[model samples]
Target: KGKAFFVDLTLCTACRGCQVACKQWKDLPAEETRNVGSHQNPQDLSAKTIRLVRFNEVKEDGKLKWLFFPEQCRHCIEPPCKYIGNMYADGAVKQDPVTGAVIMTDKTKGITRLESWEMCPYNVPRRDEESGIWNKCDMCINRISKGMLPACVKSCPTGTMNFGDRDEMLALANARLAEVQKTNPDAYLADPEHVRVIYLCESAPENYHDRLVASAAQRKNLVAAAPKPKTVTRR
Candidate 1:
């Protein structure tokens, strides 16, 4: 039974503590970023920035609502990145049987970037050009293996990010969703069954962030665009 994460958007403050903790724990360096006229700094995920707290200001029912989404990899139950990666490099991308963490290995250098990324629905994967390896949140496997919560989860000041067993988290997500629905009618759990990271959104999913969940149309387009493997014949 792999572990899972339940993130409560209703409780998130967008303090970016989880974001900063991810960098600190991973020893990832900061990128030079300019103020982009929004609280969402750095603006996007990259080789260095694995987790980002997205801020969206939207008007709902004549009232402006501040939506904060602490975004990271969903770590799909049957990870497409790993499925496709195995074709090119067996160990390039893999899902942990014990923790449900999706890890990108150095051998990812052997897989084509476009193929690997196209397979992902949430578009979470980022590549390091010089190193030629895809990277994303490994669910803080280093700490979790030692029986600790993920760095981001530990760093959250508010009771937003949560980690635990898949069943327990799913139950918690549903229960929280029900409670949130009592107040905000738009609450829903984003892809709870298919992903290890479950996000309980208190508003419309679109208002929280684009790419919040994978869609069938996008998946089809990606499958259509994938490059055909080149075959070599032994003489």
Candidate 2:
């Protein structure tokens, strides 16, 4: 009964409506930015911006292609950030049992290391330098609990952002992937089995973003670096 998101990158026009909607719904303050020759503003996600639309310009077949990636937390079935953060302070990060949404809580302020962020393959979490708290997309849990769609999904003009029950989203993602593969042979769903936020990429996941999908080697390293839980002793 968990919830999920299906992001069809092929359909994304990079209007940034989802990005704005996230900020509005979260009541997050805007970051001051400057023109950096690229359309991608704010440079990267931060405590003020949990979600970001990453613009990447790459050359493919001697032709320039602009890839728009609306990046956010993948809300993994087993979140590494939650595990890593809990190693320092229990409940620093929590996953919603019903929706499987990964959320960073106030307890994160107590964490001393950057292990939580390091453990995340997607590079989603952003830390507040002043408060030492981490932040990221929370799947709009409050709005969804009220029988409403996530702000980003609700405001998306393109068919890029989608949300619903995990099974339903998986079906939708696969169906779209099949349709897209006819045109773009490289089209595939990014980490669909392990992540709740499934992305239908038109090309290789790396063509859109470096950390768009964790590679096999990256996964192996993450597993090797994971800290084992400390055993409790009965007094």
Candidate 3:
């Protein structure tokens, strides 16, 4: 019923094409940045920079391997941010019924910025200092409405980004995982069944990125709270 993106992390070259394309299509300005030794730039996602290709270099078997993760919103099956936002301003953050896109709307201008972040387990959303609204990957709803792929998916030169119906994407994700496991037995699919943006990582999911998916610790906290959406007031 919903759409998804199956990202093969092994194939990602960290070219950052998806990053540039997202900025271009969203008309978001660049943040001031300096060389950080690694090819990854800007360090992290911001209000203007929604899609980021995160690079993590780790030593394995005495060899350094770079893991590139083109990170974006997972568009969770049960988005906690949407529930938290609805408490303060209904429709501020909603999951699109048709496409399953977890989008932050203009009504987000009314929500407490810190609460929005606290509610999001993945820590994906960013607040705009000027507009007071939140921003993150929207799955290019504007383009999808016209029957097109998301900007980042379209711009990816490698076959790392694949998008389609949820079932189709799942099938592809599993198939890719099987193939990758032959060479790297530790390969896995990160939260494939729980989110629309599925990542096929070549090693332990954590070796890819800290927030590659909602952490187990965060899940434990959510469970301890009885999954209640706590209201967050401005500090």
Candidate 4:
């Protein structure tokens, strides 16, 4: 019953089909973006943008390598953001026991502005300007539960975005890593064991984001500092 998603950065062509698909299915509006020098558009994820294709160019072994990471919520088994948000508003955020999908309910409107929205490690949650309701990727739970792939996965023509059971995804990630290592020995899986969404990167995860693969100590701190269930229970 364990749910998971795999992102093979090595196979990603940076086509951004997944990004556009997310917006299309979620009905999210586009943001006005400027020429940011990079082909990456919209600059960053906002309340309206849940998924983004991150591009990074780095020098490796006297050659320039372009890395692409289609980033979104990791849907941690023990979600810190859910703990933090529920402290201010009960039932505002819930994690699906079966799929481990972290969902923000409309009740998120009751959460304090600062407490609920700013505590996520990946900055996944976004608040509606008027309603103050928080939102983020739900792992496309409705589709997943119905035996269908997520829209992003469906639209990915490059075979980069994959979804399956946790064990199957891990096996696919390892097999792909072996193939990628034939040319790039530094390739590895980022936080494979800890997160539901696993990413395979050819270079160090830092080349994508500082928090891409958090250190054990940092993860421990996050878990320890997470709000307690009792603190969030309401009358």
CA RMSD per model (angstroms): 3.3, 3.9, 2.4, 3.5
lDDT of each candidate versus the true structure: 0.85, 0.86, 0.83, 0.81
Say which prediction, candidate 2 or candidate 3, comes out ahead on lDDT.
2
RMSD of 1: 3.3
lDDT per residue for candidate 4 within 114-184, as digits (tens), equals 54324576666778787788778889888899999999999999888999999899999999999999988
- The candidate 2 region of ten consecutive residues with least summed lDDT is 226-235
Pairs clashing within candidate 1: none
Q: Which candidate wins on lDDT? A: 2
Q: Compute each candidate's TM-score over C-alphas.
A: 0.92, 0.92, 0.92, 0.89
Q: What is the lDDT of candidate 1?
A: 0.85
What ranges in model 3 sit over 4 Å off? 113-117, 215-234
Over 1-235, each residue of candidate 1 has an lDDT whose tens digit, in order, gives 6899999999999999999999999999998999978777988899899999888999988999899988899988877777666666878888788998999999888776363357688888888878888789999998999999999999998999999999999999999999989987778888876789999987777887768877656665665555544552322
Candidate 2 C-alpha lDDT tens digits along 1-235:
6999999998899999999999999999999999989999978988889889999898988999999999999998878787777776888899889899989899988666564446688888888999999889999999998889999999998889999999999999999988988888888899998899999987767778878887656655775676544542323
Quickly count the clashes in candidate 4. Answer: 0
Q: Across residues 157-223, which tens digit of lDDT does each residue of candidate 3 receive?
A: 9999999999999999998889988988988888776789999987776787767777556754643
